[model samples]
Target: MVIVLKNQLRIVKKNIRQFIENITSLFSSKISDLLLAILLIPYLISKVGIENYGRYVFALSLTLFLVNIINYGFDLSAVRELAKNRHKPKMLKKLLNKVLSVKLYLTILMLVILFVVVFTIPLLRVEKTMYFFALFLIIGDLFSLRWFFMGIEKMKYIPIINVGSKLLYVFLVIIFIKQSEDYEIIILLEGIGLFIVNIFSFLYIVRKKRIRIKLISFYKVKCPVLK
Candidate 1:
């Protein structure tokens, strides 16, 4: 019937509009990240000197190496599973609980490995403090609801959350970092920025999406491991 066709057309148009909005927001956020990085990197490099900058990079790189290991490729799986079941609120909550539980276990295991590597490696041992500071990055990343929002195909809030946190980070860095000794604050800022953005995003989801994150047992279903 014509009414059925009209309804379908309206739905299609609405979805298209939403898709465009999501893309625009995501793009803008990415641009902001790039611009912020471009502005900060030169100032940081010159302020800290080459040797200190290298050390900081080395520490962050080592930390991110663990990140790759900790993630263990759950990103795609989470997006697929969550996105497929986005319409069902109960299912979304259940999936989120399971994902968080599994990720927590994974984090514990990865952290054990991380500390082992940090203690054994000479480079990491020297930068032990920074290495430890960078570990919070993993926690920040894990708690980030980026996958959840991406699954639901809602991206408007991400830009706001990301930019706000980054702005604060920039402010802190500018105010506090003056010389090489202050380079430790850089990694901490990265971790803090991630933590803050995720906190904002998580709270937004809880309030606006009406999703509760409770500790649920994964015993009933076969839980998927990151490995």
Candidate 2:
């Protein structure tokens, strides 16, 4: 009886360790992301000045609004699949392909509509049209990569990449912008920074996981039956 109890305790301890590791990984990732945002905002404001910063914020808000329209709650579906089949490559690939296909199409459509709005809408006071273009790409790429990571349960990488990118942006901002008047350039720099970082990270994941970008043939992959 004592031997059996000792074995049970060992099992419980092992489980506890695994749980702790998962939680720690997630916590570290989230903390890094929050820190990046906190640092980037001040750097942006200082470099861009108040008026330009306000314009940047408005552009970002509009980008977010458009992203939400394309997403249509598909993020939740990806998360559910990732949780259920983290270890199954085939399942993960299928779900990811489906989600990516839908997102890609939606993103293209949104870009077209946004291009018209930015061009026609006089209220969007965006001086550099390239800045809006960069903003759209950055937001779309980041959002898609986020869903991919969440599904795979490899979220530890997200914060590291996000924070590292922001840090690089800070360095670039200081190096390039000597005057506060260069707000348009600085804003464009910020967007370009995010775009480059996300692209690198996304490529890394694809290479590491050997994920092939194939067209999803079937409309539906069997999802896990929840209890």
Candidate 3:
């Protein structure tokens, strides 16, 4: 009886530790995102000028819309799958890979569609180039390593990477804005920053967590579809 009680207590303690770690990591990452957003708004507005800033914002809005269309709610679904099969690392990996594969294919299709729309729509013609390039941001957000962290519930590293990347981006933006007032430069910076951050985080997860998609391992499962 005492042994059983001790084992339960130990398990509880471990869970609590993990919970605290995840929370702390999330907090750190959010703080970084908050700071970056705050700094980016002023820097972007000031560097690009009000008129160009509005155009940039419009392009960004379009990019986000396309990103959502491409994502088709797979991000949340992947996380849920991971949570459901937390005990089975192999299963989680399979699920994650399948979802990722689907997302990648969808993203490519969306990009092509968006490219067509950007060229065909008269109103979007002026900002077409910018919007096209903005696809990188959408891809970055979709493939963000943060999703994997959320799935595995080992979120401590996410915030660290997220925050560090945002800070580095902010620094780069400052340097660029100091030298020029080109709105395209600012927009490019934003897209590139997001790409770099996501890539870095994804690489970190792959290297440290050994998260990978094995095409043969994935089995058909009714994954919860999120809207």
Q: Considering summed lDDT, which 10 consecutive residues are worst modelled in model 2? A: 218-227
Which candidate has the highest lDDT of all?
A: 1
User: What's the ranking of the predictions by TM-score, best on top?
Assistant: 1, 3, 2
TM-score for each model: 0.89, 0.76, 0.82
Cα RMSD of predicted structure 2: 4.2
Ranking by lDDT: 1, 3, 2
- 1 or 2: which has the higher TM-score? 1
Judging by TM-score against the true structure, name the best candidate.
1
Listing every candidate in turn, what is its Cα RMSD in Å to the true structure after a full C-alpha superposition? 2.5, 4.2, 3.5
Question: Over the stretch 157-215, how does candidate 2's per-residue lDDT look in tens digits?
Answer: 66676676667777777788765666656556666677778778877877887889775
Residue-by-residue lDDT tens digits, candidate 1, 1-227: 99999999999999999999999989999999999989988989988888888888887887777777656656688778888888888888887777777777667777888889889998778878877888778788777776677788877877887888789788878887898898876888888878887877777777886777776455632356422
Model 3: residues with Cα > 4 Å off, grouped in runs: 178-181, 209-227
How many residue pairs clash in model 2? Answer: 0
Which runs of model 1 end up more than 4 angstroms from their true locations?
A: 216-227
Tens-digit lDDT track for model 3 on 61-123?
Answer: 877787777665555776776777878877766666676666666677778887898889888
Those runs of model 2 whose alpha carbons end farther than 4 Å from true positions after fitting are 1-43, 125-131, 135-143, 216-227
